[model samples]
Structures are given as C-alpha cells and as structure tokens.
Target: MSTKFPEIQGGGSLILAWQIKGKEVLVVAAGRIVNLLNADAKVTVVCPRNGLNEEVAYRVNNGQVKHVDRVFLPVDLEPEKKVAMVLTAIDDPDASTRIWKYCKQMKVPANIADVPSECDFYFGSVHRDGPLQIMVSTNGNGPRLAAAIRRQIGQMLPEGTGDSVKRVGQLRRKLRKVASGKTSRDISKRMAWMSEVCDKWSTDDFNDMDDEDMDKLVRYYESGEVPSFEEIRLGSRDHVVWEFDGTFGWM
Candidate 1:
C-alpha cells in the first residue's frame, strides 16, 4: 500500500567530515552531477545505462571511476571499505532516503546531489588558488543562484589571478625557514602585500614588475607585522556565512 508521507516544509542539512581522496565513493546520479565533479576520490558511478553514458561516464572511463549499469542499491557496492561519500541526484525521495540510511550503516559520508537535508556534506561553487581555496555554497538548495554569484565573483578578480597565486606559492615553499614558521608571520605579510598589489595592479604595472620589484614585494610581505591594505596582492579574505532563517512550524 502506498502511504503518503508529509513533505517537510523547510530544508535542513549537515556537513559531514570525510575526505574522499583515494577513498571509495559511490555516485548514484542519472544527471550531470557525477560528470561535472569527475568522481573525486576513488569513485564509482551506478546508474541506468542509457543516462549514465553521457560525458560524466566518459570522463570516468579515463580511470577516474568505474561504472555499473544499475540504480542505487547499497548492498551492491561494498561499503565495508567505508566509502567516503555517496552522491544521489535522483528525484525520488525514497531512493535518496534509502541511500542516506545506507551511508549511516556503512559509516560513510553521503551527499544526495540536490537533497541537502539528507546529505552529510554539501558541494561548493569553488574559487581555487592551489592550496589557497575559496569556496561558496548555499547547501545545494539554490545552485543556480550560487552559480550566478560565482560568475559575478569571476568578474571581480584580476586577470591572471591563477598565475599570480601560483608564483606566490612557489616562493612560499622555497623558503625552508619560512615554511617551518621561522618567518611564518613574515611570509603571511608578504602574501598579503602580494594580494593588494594584484588587486590594484594596472595593465602596465603587471607587465612592468621586474625581478627586483618582486623580491621587494616578498620582503615587504615577510618583514612587517602589519600588512597595509594598499599592498594586498592576492585574494580577498572576506567570507559569506550561510545560515537558515529560523521559521519552521513542525508537522
């Protein structure tokens, strides 16, 4: 007999702590979620053959992940390895709920693609800087809105932000004493100056900064307790906190 379950009016979510890198992960999606993420971690995609064969599977075929022609069945994938995260993008609530229960039993973190309330962790619209990364997410409820914001942020960034950060990272690693914190604050300050410089740099400024100027900038970052904002040469430290507006009436 089909009994109706009341739909929860508002959404709730949790961010479970589990790093999927080199760990088993099961993805159950008929959509593009798996394709886009390229199955991070030791990933496997299980979906109906027709829908799963899209670009996502193509990428997976490059030794990114293994694929099984099936729907979501927790028993099929041995979660004993404590697979890191299971992603489900299906529209079926029961299927999503079942996947959630399976993760709990296996002690694995799970994220049901579009279902944040049933997830352990939520994905972010990322802004990466090698080891320095900035991520923004709205718990998966509003990915379109999140994506729009991400585009706006892209425009705000200076040209060659990636190149600039990469250069900074190489320098930071080379200074052994600084890497070990002998000059941690100094290196941090230099990084700050670099950010300011990058932010306000004119087309000519970027083209003209010589080896001497770059060295001076590094010294400025390392030599000071206070990094002036005018010299911020890298990225923004600003953050957007995600919080739910509490207005729920229990069913």
Candidate 2:
C-alpha cells in the first residue's frame, strides 16, 4: 500500500520532528552552525578540531561539539538508532561527499543544507494567517524564490479568510448530514445545487453570517427551495449608465 503524506505545514517544527524521529541526530558542520540549533533531538556536532570556532561551540553548549581532525562519521552508530544526519559543511565538497556517502551506506536520511543537489528534502517557506497556512516549495531549485512567492501570496489574502474557512466547515457538515444515505447521483445533484448557491455568496454574506442565518441557509438547501431575499437582492442591483458619443449622450 502507498503511504499517504499529510498536508504539511512548513516550519521548524515540521523539519525538527521529521529529523528527531529516533530522538538523536548527528549534525556535521565546519561553520554556520546556528541552523542546527532547532533540531529537537540530542544533537552531536562533528566538525574539524582545528576549524571549530569558539562561538559555534558555545551555541551548542560547548561540550556538545565533537572535535574531529577529519569529517568521518562513526560507522558503528546504527542507522536505525540515529534518526537523521545534517551536513552544513557545504563549502568542502570532498568532506560533504564522504559524509553523504557514509549516511547513504548507513541508510540514514541526510540533509546537506543549501546544497539541493545533495539533499533528500527541501525546507519550504511558510505564511500563516490565523488558521490558514500557505507553503511554497521549489522542489530543491530555489528556496529564496519560494520565500518571495510566499510573501506575495500572504499580502493578497483577506484578513477574514480564516473566518470564511470556519463558516465553510459548518456548511460542509450540514451538507453531509443532509446528503447521508442518498444515492451517488442524488449526492452529486445536491453538490451541484450547492455549487450554484456558492456562486451567489459575497464577501459580505460570509462576514455577516450568524448561527441563525446559517441554519436558515441549511434549511433552504435541505428543502431545495430558493430563499426570497436572493431574488429581491439580485433584482435591485441593476443599473444603467449613459455615455456621450463626442457631441450627444447615447443611451
């Protein structure tokens, strides 16, 4: 059976949770060590003994930094016991390659930060608006581009979008109960009818709905009867505009 992936919300939690599945992670880096701080697991930082900076070591609680002359992971550490491997030593191609090879041999999932070619996963840029979350991914091509796109989309969303989602959820539950035990054809017909009703929805309609208003709308759907307000509202909105054709006004 194929495994179904959940709708992932992009954030540090998602990345950290996936990496810390086994409660331990090995972070191999030479510099730029701050990125690994978010890993939820007990992290062991492996770096060049001579190349290790005091500041970097201090960030991971000093003693957590393992001083190794060369970038070589412990072969005896069972892959099943270790949840993940993160390589931030992207500048040294040879060391990164060796570490990646070792990770592959051990059957551990590895992420070579900023090096998409060597990475198995790509972190996405996320935008949050109340209960709504929008994530953008480049499939390892460009992360900054994804972030830029996320910002643009975030700007366009209305502030009341989260409230709209809640209202829609209520409508969905009511429809499901109304359509329960119906034939496939009958359900499809009801869905089509609801689609027409949705076409009539305005931003104001969503914004103004109270429990009583929602209950009335639900009754209209259950009975297959059009609401009287809809006819009057739609009919009163027509307007005529006049334009001048250079010298005279044309109707």
Candidate 3:
C-alpha cells in the first residue's frame, strides 16, 4: 500500500487536492483524462497500448501528454517523479485499482474510476473561452447533471469568449510583473482599468498581437499587485472569480 495523500476540503466536501504554486504535474491515464488536463504540469499519459488516436490528441493541441506504450510495473513506476497528481483510467478495474493502490502507498495524490469510494476527486467537464472557463462538476455522482449544466453554460456564454479571455490573462500576467502590491488604491484602479478595457475591447479594434502586448497587460495588472484568486464582475456585470492556478494543469 502507498502512503496517504492529503485531501482538500472545498465547497463543504473533502476531495483529493494539492497546492502546486509552481510544480510539474504528471498524468498517468488514458484517453480523455490525458486530453482534458493542461497548464503547468509535465504530463505523461501511461498506457499499455495505443489507446489515444491521433485525431483525439490533435484536438487538445497541447505539447504535453507524452505517450509511453507500456504497462505499469511496480518496479518501473516512479512514485516520486516530482509528480503532483496521477489519474488512472486503465479500463480494467483491477489494473486501475492496482495503480491507485501503488500511488497511495507512495504518498502521491491519485484517483481511479468505477471506484468512487476510493477516489478523492473526479475531473469535471469544462467550457473555456479567452480568460474564462466554466466547469461543471458532479462530484463523480451525476454525469447527467454535469452534462445538463454544460448545456446551460453553453447557452449563457457568447461565442469567442475563450479567445477574449486569453488575451486578458496574457495582459494581466504582463502587468503583474512590474506592478506593485500593498496598495489598495492601485489594485482597485487597475481592476477598474482592466474592466474598462475589457468592456471596450470588442469595439476599440484593439487585440493582442504579440508577446509584448500580453506582457504589457501583465505589467499593468502587477501595478495593482492583484493577489491570487481574483473575483471580478464580467463585462462589468456579473461576478466571476479567476484564480486558475495551474493546479489542474493535467487532468
């Protein structure tokens, strides 16, 4: 048996969690699990055969998710490979269970399928646009509910939202680097400034072109010195929080 992985409490539920401010993530799963996760992790999907088709891999379009056509071996599995999390979807209960057992014994956070009792957390379905990503999670109990929520979200969000969001985030990241903290006024002012820009973004004929422009936005955000987990109203209307640490870097 593996060691214990710490569980995190969120929304009044205990789930498998990790706080990786800046850590490499390794995903050990097949198909959808590997394709879903993205961001800061060094993701590598462990599979026994060529489970993922090329077309499916192209959809995610991320450089991560390396493929190793090999079965899991206790001797070869590096439980301590600077990995933040592991997800197993081996299609076989016994195989997935075995992998989960090993990760547990090794003290790494992990999850398995068809065994909710043993899972700490299950991945959620998400919709992404520029800087906004809406997730529909059913706590592994109701896929039907998740799908229903996804439909509602699809109706709520307008098209081209993801592209707009990415532009904003790139800009914020740039601003953060040169911005100052400890000043409430700066933060407020910057937030307001961002709001203004975003509001007129579609009409101003302004769009992010290169790395420099994105960095400029990040630098501007830094001037506010905004902290992690920022909550801002969308289009100067509805409240939306954006923390999005690269925690779920790899699903």
Q: Highest lDDT among the candidates is held by which one?
A: 2
Question: Taking the tens digit of each residue's C-alpha lDDT, what string does model 1 give over 140-161?
Answer: 6578887788878877887766
Ranking by TM-score: 1, 3, 2
- Residues 102-217, candidate 3: write the lDDT tens digits: 87887766767558766766666766553465667777768788888888997876566666666667666655555655489877766776776666455212333457444433
List lDDT for all candidates, in order: 0.61, 0.61, 0.58
Top TM-score prediction, candidate number: 1
State every prediction's TM-score relative to the real structure: 0.61, 0.47, 0.57
Clashes of 2: 0
**230 in model 2: Cα distance from truth in Å?**
6.0
Name model 2 segments beyond 4 Å from true.
Answer: 1-111, 138-142, 182-197, 222-251
Each model's total of backbone clashes = 16, 0, 31
Deviating ranges (above 4 Å) for candidate 3: 1-29, 33-37, 50-64, 76-80, 170-179, 182-251
Q: Give per-model CA RMSD.
A: 16.2, 11.2, 14.3
